[model samples]
Target: MITLKNVNVNELESAAQSCDFILPIEQTAVWASYQATIEGRKPWGCFIIQQDEKPLAFISLIDFETHGYHYVRSMHGPAWLEHPTQELETQVLQALATQLKQADKNLVFMRVDTWYDNLAVPVLSTVPYNQTVIISLEGGYEEILKRMKTRGRRDVRKAMRECPATCMDETERAYNDFSEYYEVMVDTGKRDGFVPAPLSDYTDMLGALGKDHCRVFAARVDERVVGWSIITMHGPVAVRYYAAMRSDAMHMFVTDRLLYAECCMLYDLGVTHYDLMGIGNDFAPSLKGLNVFKTKFSTEIIPVAAGRDIPLRPVYYKALTTAKKLRKVLKH
Candidate 1:
């Protein structure tokens, strides 16, 4: 029989590192702290799945309430030490459901966006999904650069020679220039036609992640911040969690140069893998431009598992689904 035990944040983080999972920034305790501190979403629930008292997997989740129902979400996790068999995976899911329902009588569902793609599940995903590019930082700088596409290498060299932007890491300081970063992100969103998160979210992120797990960098030209990158590290992997470059910076290729420099910097700091997180899959036409830019730097396109929403209260789940559909239709 599978059992789930509640774990503290440190235990959760340690398990993730020990397992060497390709955890997204969202899945870390750093992110949980940020969500709690900034978004008022607490207390974080970390669970360890066990069989006969031996730990099998670790999962960190958060509680969210909508329309008078509470739910749990685990982003890109329950990472297993060894890949679990299909039967074990299903058993774990059922255990979680029984445990969560017992803990919170109002719990309606549990949604998990897993890291392992092949893990089979009984239900389809209720969340949007995207593919991401992973670049191994295994070798030296030259070797790493050599692994990029020829066009990417050319662009990096050209950008390095021509752009001449200054890079600054502000990980040690509180992110006071979030307004400036948000401004650039807004401009980028407008040009790219995607909505940007509010400035406060970034402020919370910086505050929560702090210097140890997070690095905020800026590319400056003429003393103005033209591009920014918010990078987060978990275990040996680092993700470019959020980045934005002004349109003018794009013209001069400052964005490319800054990104290359940052990757090198992270490599030197002992990060073994870097993710240019979230590119469009074959299904997303809108992600073409973004995909083209990121794919140039990637050695591999990683497939994350499909998200699954397991309903504790089937009637409420059906009602919520119908409500969401109706809302979308009415808005349109």
Candidate 2:
């Protein structure tokens, strides 16, 4: 049953708003359109799933090809309007599987990173994510500070006293000019032992989203850039996507001030939630430091369902899983 028929990217507002887990920026059409603008990759599509003429789910797929086989990745979605029963979810997954198989004989697998917790259909594999942190910006600035950890509040006070934070000009030049911020991001990635995105990628992302949807905040100590962040404000939520700080500025608490300033900025613009992005599941060692920093100001931790891979071609799926295991061993 095509409960929802031929729902295009432009027609995603109603579907996206129906689901609590699906943020406005995370709408299938928005991401698929952005991906298409990029140079590489395969065909992609955006669709909405409905029940009883009411939108229930939204998914965007990228038909990636490798070794003569095609696999679909539903980016951060198949987000639901509400908690789905196991039977309902299974039927939806099966319907999707049948549809993809008939559309492309070479299709081997469909991978989904479901949002929220539900009994999704069993899959070949799962990708885990740490619980995420979010802060409600509804109570206004003073109420926001009142919810922060005592130490966090103290640091913010110190940061204000020592080094103030400010948003750069909300102009196209600041958004496109990645020269200064890119350097800090590289240094931060090396210090944190993670790879940073290339300058071209940021340029492309800002260009696609435009200055109205994205903004950059910078912290300074006596005219020197100490910390910076790139945030996206879409729908009702604002996410601090990329952030970096100078190693020397850590003790100065520049990062704290930068984050607080951004929250205020978003609040002024009527955004109600601030997502600190990904964090450890339970203060795990891997992200202990990062988690500690975000937890200080977070209202709660939200655990979203991770990615799962379902096989359309069982034999090829086995081979792919085997290769993945082998690669992991080789890396070790």
Computed on alpha carbons, the lDDT of every model, listed in order, comes to: 0.76, 0.70
lDDT of 2 by residue, 1-332 (tens): 43534566656656565454554475545556555666545435667787776677777677766566777877556767676776777777777877877777777888876542343334544334537788888888887788777877777777778765554533354575778778888888888888987888777777777776777778766666667877877777888877889887777777777888887878888889898877765523355566878988865677765566778888888887788789899999
Candidate with maximal TM-score: 1
lDDT for residue 177 in candidate 2, whole number 0-100:
72
What is the C-alpha RMSD, rounded to one decimal, of candidate 2?
A: 3.4
> Candidate 2, which segments miss by more than 4 Å at Cα?
1-4, 14-23, 65-69, 115-130, 164-173, 282-289
TM-score of 1: 0.88
Displacement of the residue 256 alpha carbon in candidate 1, Å: 1.6
Q: What local lDDT score does residue 20 receive in model 2, on the 0 to 100 scale?
A: 47
Error of 1 at 331 (Å): 2.8
What would the TM-score be for candidate 2 when compared with the true structure?
0.85
**Candidate 2 local lDDT, residue 204:** 73
Best by lDDT: 1
Candidate 1 per-residue C-alpha lDDT over 43-114 given as tens digits, one digit per residue, 9 for 90 to 100 = 548887889977788788888765576778777667677777777787888788888888888778888755
